[model samples]
Target: MQKYLPLFPLNLVVYPMEALNLHIFEPRYRTLINECLDNGTTFGIPAFINGKLPGFGTEVKVTALSKKYEDGRMDIKTEGIRVFRILDFQNPMALKPYAGGLLEMLPMPEVRPFVMVGLVERVKTLYRFIDEENTFDVNKPQPYSYQIAHKIGLTLEEEYQLLKMPTEAERQGYLIQNLERIINTLQEIERTKERISMNGHFKNLDPLNF
Candidate 1:
């Protein structure tokens, strides 16, 4: 579906079903959130990475207006609904404080059991090594790969790539590859640390009795 949505560009990627809490302080954004809350509407958060705005982002809807300050600032909770590709960005609409953009909603693929299982096991190992083994729940329904992406130490660029993936299977594959690379790096670091530690330790050698 193609439609116009209020755009919030940030240096992070939000995945579907992910909950995000935002503090609206800028006058533009404050106005934007207020409009959405008042009208029961949604907004698109386009990925703003490395000083550039990406073509894709997730559409999110406000779930709660947790606080409103006397200065017109707000604390709101929102959940991502789906991914959208920006068609064109528009400056603030007439009499509006924030910007709006045309977007094409993308098709979200169904979960692939094989991919999910493989990635889940790899992530389990990763967490165990890091002593955060209980951080992720594999049995949870719709445990999409992004849920564990941050836990696996994926960089913002890597996360953006996962967000751009056309299917959950592809995302799972990406996560598995990423986790393997990170795990191998961590193991290497541990070995290096062990070697370094041994260098300063006393080697107990029996004095030769002449």
Candidate 2:
């Protein structure tokens, strides 16, 4: 469906089903947050990359306004609902201080078990590398790729690319590749550390067979 979305560009990526907590202090953002709260509406946060706003972003709803300071600053909780493609951007819309845009909502795929057992196991290994193995509980509700994207040490650009993927399968595939590459890099770093630690230590050497 096509509609207008209030835009909040940031340096981070927002994924559907992800919960984000934000502090509103700027005069412009204070205005934006107040309007959304007063009208019971949502906003779009696109990954602001390379000093430019990207065409893709996730639409998020303000679930709660936890605190409102006397100066009008706010602490708000939001949950991303879906990905959106910017059809047109209107900065300083009419009398409003924030930006708005014509947006096309992108449908997200239904939650399903990732069939690749290798990828699941790899994800487990990934968690182990990062000392977060306990957080990768298989029994918990699977939000799939978005659940673990941030935990695996993905760059903002990688996360942004992942957000644009329309299907769960495609996102999983992308994640699988990244996980393997990261795991290997971690393994190499560990090996290097071990080698450095063993320097100047006495070692037993086997005589070569002539």
Candidate 3:
């Protein structure tokens, strides 16, 4: 179904179920947040890359107002709900400080089990290589590709592409390919570092020390 939503264009991509914390300093956004909080509505954060708003974005609902300053600035926490594609954008909507757009919801398909399992393992492996504390929960009834997207060193554009994917299997496949490339690059870098660290080593010099 087509619907209209308040627009909050941001330079970041937020995937469904991802948490985002934002500081509202601008008067327009402050008002927007206040209205959403009052009405219990959601706002769209369309991807703003290279000064252009991407057609696709996530709808987010405020979860908490962590801080409210005396000056009216706010620190808010939000969680992404779903992806929406903008059918038409209205800048400065009806003389309001914020923009509005017509959006079409993009529903996600049930995650394919085999694909999700493979991707989860790949993600865990990538995290291990980087020595990161793995917090991925693969046992969830429905695992999402976004759970590992940010952790796998995906570029903003790549994340957006993953967001645009229509099905869970496709997203999982994209992540697997990306992780493979990233792991290979990381391995090459580590090898180069090991070679560089031994640049001045000499067997004859080591024998004298011994």
Candidate 4:
């Protein structure tokens, strides 16, 4: 079944079960948020690249809301519900910055616990390295697939690929491939650092002169 929903395009990719915090200041999106509040409705979040919306997006539930000012601005926290594919889009002639679209729900496969656990472990290891190097501070390990996806630095295109996968196994496979690549890249960096250190030590050695 296809239904029309208000669309909110963003530069970042949102996955199922992830939480996002948004500040609503634009007039059009503020109207959209108000509509959702009035009707207990959900909205679609599509990735925007070069001002173009991706065909696939996630439906999100507004879990928390607060009015920010007398001007009707709002601060909202939302969690992703499910994936949807855009069937059609309509852009009114008005000056609204956001776009609205007709969307069809995408079916999700039951993900296995073991596979999910493995992926989580991989992400944990990656974050551990980040914390050790003081590159970033993530409070705790994320508990769900979407959170893991966000932490792994997946591009919007790659995230769309995950959303399009028809089965849990396929998504797991994709995550595993990305995890392997990340691990390899980190290892290469370590090797390069070791080589540089060794060269510096050799350069410092006292020269033997006859």
Better TM-score candidate (2, 3): 2
TM-scores of all predicted structures: 0.91, 0.92, 0.89, 0.81
lDDT of 3 by residue, 42-89 (tens): 999999988898799999999999999999999999998889999999
- Number of the predicted model whose TM-score against the real structure is largest: 2
lDDT of 2: 0.85
RMSD of each: 3.0, 1.9, 4.1, 4.8
lDDT of all the models against the reference?
0.84, 0.85, 0.85, 0.74
Q: Which residue pairs of candidate 4 clash?
A: none
Off by over 4 Å in 2: 112-115, 137-142, 206-210
lDDT of 1: 0.84
Q: Evaluate model 1: give its TM-score.
A: 0.91
Rank all candidate structures by their lDDT, best first, as comma-separated numbers: 3, 2, 1, 4
lDDT (10s digit) by residue, model 4, range 1-210: 676788988887777767889999999889888878888999998877667776888889898895567898999999887788888887741455567888998864343233555765677777776664323223333224444666676776887777777666677778878987897788799899888888745366687999
Give lDDT tens digits, candidate 1, residues 20-98: 9999899999888988988999999999998988788999999999999999988999998888999989877666778
Q: Quote the RMSD, in angstroms, for model 4.
A: 4.8
lDDT, candidate 2, at 90: 91
Q: Sort all candidates by TM-score, best to worst.
A: 2, 1, 3, 4
Which of the two, 3 or 4, has more lDDT?
3
